[model samples]
Target: MNHSVTLKDIAKALNLSISTISKALNDSHEIGADTKQRVLDYAKEHNYLPNRMAKGLKEGKSRSIGVVVCSLDNNVIAQMLDGIHKVCTDKSYQIIIMQSKESEKLESACIELLYAGGIDGILISPAYETINFNYLLSLQESGLPVVLFDRLIDKIHTHKVGADNFKGAYEATKHLINNGYRNIAHLNTNTILSIATERLNGYKQALADHGIPCREELMVSCNYTGATSLNENLEEAIKSYMSLENKPDAIFTATDQISTRCLVILNKLGYRIPEDIALIGFTNTELADAMNPPLSTVHQPAFEIGKLAAEKLFSLIEKKNIDEDFETVLLPIDVQVRASSQPSNK
Candidate 1:
């Protein structure tokens, strides 16, 4: 058979009618097991692919999943995408990935294009600048399913999968405090997302619980602009922290980008990891262990988060008459110790 082999081609080759071939392919009750096996063997031999467009036209479903994220370059986001791909491919659904670069306007354009392209559903990690969920809410209300993952929003109630940011931050800060670092700084994104606030609160709670005062000047919120500006802001924040009369002895960063990038900025400024100032942050980069001092990090279960998000989205897509209540799944995170966050003396 040729590259575009069809039911007719298989039927002609097997000396069977197109109806028999179609029924066998569809696993209809009328098709005998022996005959079905014969047809399947022949179809598999010739690499037969179903015309999904035709099938979608009949069933009114494109069988495609649209995914939107801030960017596809990060190691954590890449792992999440792999999980999404694994589930979608296993369930015979195609994935279309788009990046918003943390811009709400770009994210909206991506969603509009996906909707116009007849996607069955969407799995999105909203941009940091995204404050309006009205558009997504309208689409979901109109029967287009949506499930949030990673950086989530609460305006539109639906299934969401993310890591326990509070717990991760708490553990990171607690670890630093336990190492005799009272003046611990926190580097976080300037966003209204629960991730930012929860992590910030966790850091504060850890400090309060440990009887250490939380320094207002040490809690710096970096803007979510492009990379150049972000690095500039982070450098300035670090410089200000160093100039403080009682600056931080250890630093805990929030998001993946802020975590890894802050380390680079600190090194560039000639700060010694752990000896002069300890460092830890939330990140999933494989190179964490390969950094100058082998960075400590709070690692989120990004792959599992992605898989669960897609699963929940599909559940919404194939909902039955019996409506189901939405759920928010927050997975645990791990705090991996490294030399970067060792004792201040080390």
Candidate 2:
């Protein structure tokens, strides 16, 4: 196996000191412009890469931030990451992204790896099975800053940025009720994440405010999974609800992907949306508009959530205390009333 090129090799080849090569490579103003250009040219020609581990050990910073998400295949998370990448690039910081695949063990291992790599900070949307707060707490105790995005543990006091899930759910449910659909079903994820709980609370609040009785049986919990598994679970939930004596007249999905699956199942079952059962979903996506009956949904600021989380994490890493005014940043959500949940034009 070919060994990686180092600064020592570059210094030796140029007959210059390691410090001079380092400064030149970094484009330090103290180094002569000609020497800096020459070093950069040589490094580029040789495809030389600095050893991040060695640099991190010497400077106490890796100039890289670690981000762990449940999955990279998730559209919402993908968008969020795009924003994070943009900001990190703008600030000349590198990012290390990891997918835990919804496993607590894998998430812990990824965190350990990032810590060992000497990351400057961490931003995470923890796995659904994440119950061990000790790992996160230990990082904080050891002076490693972490910012939680989208999902959070209430018991762990830390910086967090996400949408107003409660408000989004409330508005969605309230819209259904106002449209004269009292029997509403909520398709939610089976997890202890604060976002899911908050959304559920919002749904309940909306029902109470509208004088609609909350039915526990109407709530269906399923694990986050692939489209096939999600679709099967959704079909079962819809069938169970439709089989009930008091069948739901409307459904509020916890996510856009779930909403799409519900539409597919409804079509296969020969149920016309808004005519037989209205539908609303969380998370605004392009597919929402292209559906046979455009899906009504709550638009979340996914990119903003990522950007704010990164900004807060960097602030903490810079030795700035943000504890005095720790806040739950709630970005605004807009409800797009589409044909799926809207009253029939006929």
Q: Identify the candidate with maximal TM-score.
A: 1
Q: What lDDT score belongs to each candidate, Candidate 1 first?
A: 0.91, 0.85
User: In model 2, which runs have C-alpha deviations exceeding 4 angstroms?
Assistant: 1-58, 225-228, 321-325
Q: How does model 1 fare in lDDT?
A: 0.91
Colliding residue pairs in candidate 1 = none
TM-score of each: 0.95, 0.83
After superposition, candidate 1 runs with Cα above 4 Å error = 1-3, 27-30, 344-346
The positional error of residue 77 in candidate 1, measured at the CA in angstroms, is 1.3
TM-score of 2: 0.83
Question: Per-residue alpha-carbon lDDT of model 1 for 130-231, expressed as tens digits?
Answer: 888888999999989999998877787989899999999999999998887888999999888888989999999999999998888999998875898889
